[model samples]
Target: MRSLFKTVLDQTKPVVDEGPRPDDKEAGIVSDDKEAANVSSERPPSSDGDDDSINKDAQPGVQKMEAITKVWSTRDLYLAYFLIWLIYFVDAIQQGMGTILTPYVTSAFQEHSLTATIGVASGIIGGISKLPLAKLIDIWGRPQGYLLTMCCMILGLVLMAASNNVNTYAAAQIFYWVGYNGISYTTTVFIADTSALRNRGLVLAYTSSPYIVTVWITGPLAQSVLNGVGWRWGFGIFAIVTPIVCLPLYFLFAWNERKAVKQGVLVRQKSTRTAWQSINHYFWEFDIICVLLLSAGFTLFLLPFSIFSVQKYGWRDPTTISLIVVGFVLLVFSAFWEKYWAPVKFLPWELLKDRTVCGACVLAAVLFIEYYIWTSYFTSFLQVVLRLEVWQTSYIANIYSIGSCLFSIPVGLAIRHTGRFKWVALYFGVPVTILAIGLLIQFRHEGTNIGWIIFVEIIYAFAGGACVICDQVAIMAAASHQEVAVVIAIEGLFSSIGGGIGGTVAGAIWTGVFPQKLKEYLPAETQDQWATIYGDLTAQISYPVGSATHAAIVAAYDDALRNMFIAATTITIVALVAVTFWRDIKLKDFKQVKGNVI
Candidate 1:
């Protein structure tokens, strides 16, 4: 089997038909004294005039703009990009539907403790499921693994649509988890294959831009639909379309799978391994420590946020909150255990130690937390403070997606050309943090215009979106070539953890502060009714509250939003400081240097 593996790799290794030639002027090798000098020096020497032109082309401004145009015009790349985006869109719709239908699900199964725990169970199980799936991608080719996962998602959605009880719904989440991991790995592997070293950064950026966009765009529609009809239909709609649309597209644009076999991308092919074999042989050589650290860090970070809504405070019940706290502690312990005791670490220890990589992780985590808080709880602010309708809220959310789309390509180009990512981080990230914080502080005031809100969000989105691209480039630069996939997986895991934590934190803060703020604003009689409506803002905020209670409810919502924003701002500042200290490693010369930052 080992011999066969070696044979396959030898046969597939790319060969350059054009071979070496004469050191002096000779046939087939346009060689001269200077050319000979270039070979000896290990640098491509150029004439003085060519050097001048090259210098001009490499200028920060000119090259940045050129890279931007090249990325924009690369239509062939968009096929894979669009497919992944569409799949994410479907996932986004599902997420929105879950939020929108929370009220209905609560009402339908309120009596059953098991039923009430269904959604929570689904999230935890799904997260745990991803680790094994990650291993599978390392073993099986990414494309085939991804196709199989899509099938799993489609099947899960079908089951979810048919489910009437909480148990089945929980099962659906597990299945959906399997599918999501598959598609994500597929898209990642595909992009890596199709893109060249020169444009790799842009390819990654192009693929990821849609991640935030799809959810925001589809979330509101799902919310609107849930309000108009029932939530079951939302899942049903996806189940019907998954096979018809997403599945076929997965195969049609399945470029990654074919390329893997053709080139033998990984060192070993599974055809030589036993059917029952594990993927240990194909594991990333040195990224284990970082992966473990990130995964654990996120698990710890996620727990407190996940149970924010259910935790107890001064006046609230402590039962759920205590349980959540315990869960969070367990997650922390797990991280520690993985960091200290895991026999085979999944994270790269050295990379984590690198100032640049560490700083990038902190920056990405902080920025993501801000993004999540705004995303998860902004709807509450819209409904509770401004009294917007569900449809109206959805309409406004589109601004964020639009903003991200507008900024993504430009940011990708800037990093590719200038190789000056730290400046880009400062330029875009600082303003976004400021706007987000300012909006929160001013939100509780008298002159909160809708147009102003829209304007701020657009500005925030543009800056934030650009910062994301810049940060990803930095992260890629901070790792070695062999660690690229592992580092990306680490990034994805941490980013998701940041979002999860932010969501939970916002929920916790909102729930903790809501009652006290309500006491200050609403009449006792109105408070209980408002609490139920608050659970689903799209259902209740747009309608008029009586003159008596309106001011108070609005003020309370603003106060809660203000606190969350302040928290977000503080984290962003920490992230910025972290970025300032990062060791700037230029990635444009990756081909020349066999490894990246470390």
Candidate 2:
């Protein structure tokens, strides 16, 4: 066995260096001599106490070692960037499909509350998976980690396509979400690895800009599929296409790692320990128990709000109460464990102590909470209340994505040029977001202008795009190179918590208030049909446009949606307050930044 393994390794090793040799001075390649000269000339003199350590860490042989630790040549870097862009383009299409899938999936169940509840559950699963996946990417190398995510997504797509019940559908969602979040987390980390701080925002924006085209294409395509073929085909098709689109990039990554290993830029470490010992080591290093505790705590605490209204005794039910209480207790235990007991901490508590990171987290959480509060049932409202066709609703609903895509590149360029994100967040992002939310509240009524609604969505999208980009840059600037992926994962966790809470709260409001309002506005004679209308959305829109029942149902929808908009606006105000605390740290190269000080 050893001889066979050795033969395979020897064959895979490169026969010669891929770049210019160390002694080739005329080639302009970054050899050992040129690297030292460049470091000395390009790096600014150390002004702070941490500069010496930063300089030492930047030395060629002293960089934090990993399975693939080599810095790429300029040509290779650009090639990697192009490959990443293609990967994100495919990813965006899948996301666009997902946006339409929510309504289709829940419509199968014929329940209003299920939509938001399912979203909360999915968010919880996705959120909890980020930390482990981040660790995996850091430890296992990006190629292996990315392949694992793809496998999960493919399996999930198969499950969803074949699902015959809501339980199966939900299980499929859990797997897909885990893969989606992992992909997103790792992609961002890869971009960070390739680009410096000065150009990071622009690179990220360019990579993400494919969302614009994908949103435009997939929104109509998804609707066409739902209208003609079926939602199952949608999932199955993407499952087949994603691997085909992404496999080339995967092979390229593997090739790069092999070349780096052969070139001596990466050192291969062989493990001598037994298999059982290796498993034990990884389990502790990944802090599996803490992951479980956190996941369970979040799931239990947040899922109840999504279902409490439908429960027999509502909030007073024993199971509901116990779930919340026990969930909170376990959350507290997890916090203490990370702070005091864990041998290897998954969440960098010390980093969280930084003012910028803390503020960014709080702001991001609040923003996501606000965003989801109204969005949880937006497509349903357009379908049931406005009586729009699937295609029409999809076009309008995805305007947010279109607007975001349009503005992201510009915002990224502006931040890159200015080297500042705080002012942009405060003066532009916050006020515009609040204005958009307010406009939505005012215009979200029966007989309101559709054009105005579309405009509001655009405004919100542009502002949200700016805020999200700025927030990401700020957080990245605050973190060191080694911690970039983990910090981003932590930010994702906050967003997930916010999404879970928002979805749960929105579900409660939707399930609790919409039905009561409908009963009040609906005539007593038609009240007997309430169950039919509530159970099946199609039944709600079956009434004629100008009829009493139709008007009453529309009014109920308008009222409930108005309340949701107000809640979102109020929450965003809190986010604005959090943004005020964000410090304006200059976007310096990570190698130059010192000790969590920013």
Candidate 3:
């Protein structure tokens, strides 16, 4: 039986890389296209290498991917692995410490409610940038893409540390998320570029291993940083260390290009078009117009929902109505443009049209939505409401990550050994996820023990871990090497949109609803203090535990957070529906997208 849904994926043609399940041949999706064939036959815009010593024993149809994989020797490949692990390590430490501090930073500006607003910006940036970055790497090369993203990350960290207000901090966050998404996408594509199908999941899991070590230490580390020179330095420290570690990887890529050129094994192509032609070329090639349309439409449509009731005129505000109307108009036009008129289709329609690819993307999207809705402010909730120490709260907050990272390895191995993930994800992951989230919703009440929270978090983590692995492999199994980059980028595209929606929902409920709840629940004497408590984490926590004011505050939080959890749990069932559409692909060498990767 075929799936009842469809989604977009695939590059125009294919390089002889990994691809969709053999059973999907009837989709007639993977065909030779002119542009893709050209890429495989000719040198790219930036050449890595073309050593005859490499790919001397090449398969008949794998020239494009072969050029990349065979260029690295066994030792160089190991070094690339080390570099990949090092980057993930550095990023994990930065995120671990930085995430705990975001609430305090917003509180410092008396706009603690704006944290989800910041997350909205992050989700949007993460969504819009992946396709552009993928296009950039395809046109230029891996080295340039990595270098650009690293600079963005370092600058963002510096700006965040020096920020004087919520606006500036939000702006800094935009840059940071862009860089974060770019680096993340580049590394993921690198793994695909190097590995065969069988070990791909295992290799991806290995990159996440740093989180296991960092999660245990970061709680105390973040607490100390917060307690000492302040949250500014908490962000500032990463700015200094990121460049020191990242520069080497950039140099390694550049070194490869230079050596390949010197050995006469690489030829660099130079464009000869007029300036006007060049401008015209990239404008359409990068699809800048659609990017603008989507960004404006999504932000306008989503942000009004968040700020509507809090605005002076509530949802009746003229500006809110105008924004939504205009946003809808622009989005409809954008969809039409992509489907009919655009020179470069952001997603190739015919090349996609597969159940496995669509299902995997939907699965990834819903998982992120289920997570971000409640988690954006969970760390702060634990510290104030539960009255746990900072380190203790941080540990519990991080338990989700620890379980996910630890469990990813075994899930990956299982997929590799069995060459199947659909049953595992649909049968095991979905049920456990539902159970965990339900337990968590129940546990949010007053007087619940800390141990129960920890257990539920761990349960959610393992379930989430398996679901993610299955989603990733299932999606990749549906794209050939030529088509895989687009598949990966679109995966980010949909997932980040889900994140944006989750943030909007959480922010709307919290900003527009929580304040009212606070007013309603506060003790009579503390009624006037609701604004102070809402704006200041310090003031919120200053109240004695078990006091009427503190109890009231906890009650208000419980009500607001409960709504978000209920919203997320309902979406989990949709993920099971999404999983049903994936094809049970076999990850055999003949079906591998790329040459034998590490």
- Best prediction by TM-score: 3
Point out the higher-scoring one by lDDT: 1 or 3: 3
Scanning candidate 1 in windows of ten residues, the lowest lDDT window is 45-54
* Candidate 1 runs further than 4 Å off: 1-82, 85-134, 155-182, 208-224, 227-229, 249-336, 339-341, 444-447, 524-543, 592-598
Q: Which candidate ranks first by lDDT, i.e. highest? A: 3
Question: Model 2, clash count?
Answer: 0
Q: lDDT scores for all predictions?
A: 0.53, 0.72, 0.74
| Model 3 worst lDDT run, 10 consecutive residues | 1-10
Better of 2 and 3 by lDDT: 3
Which regions of candidate 2 deviate over 4 angstroms? 1-75, 588-598
lDDT of 3 by residue, 260-298 (tens): 666565556678999999989979988988888887788
Candidate 1 whole-model C-alpha lDDT, 0 to 1: 0.53
Q: In model 2, what is the error at residue 37, expressed in angstroms?
A: 32
TM-score of each: 0.71, 0.86, 0.88
Candidate 2 pairs with clashing backbones: none
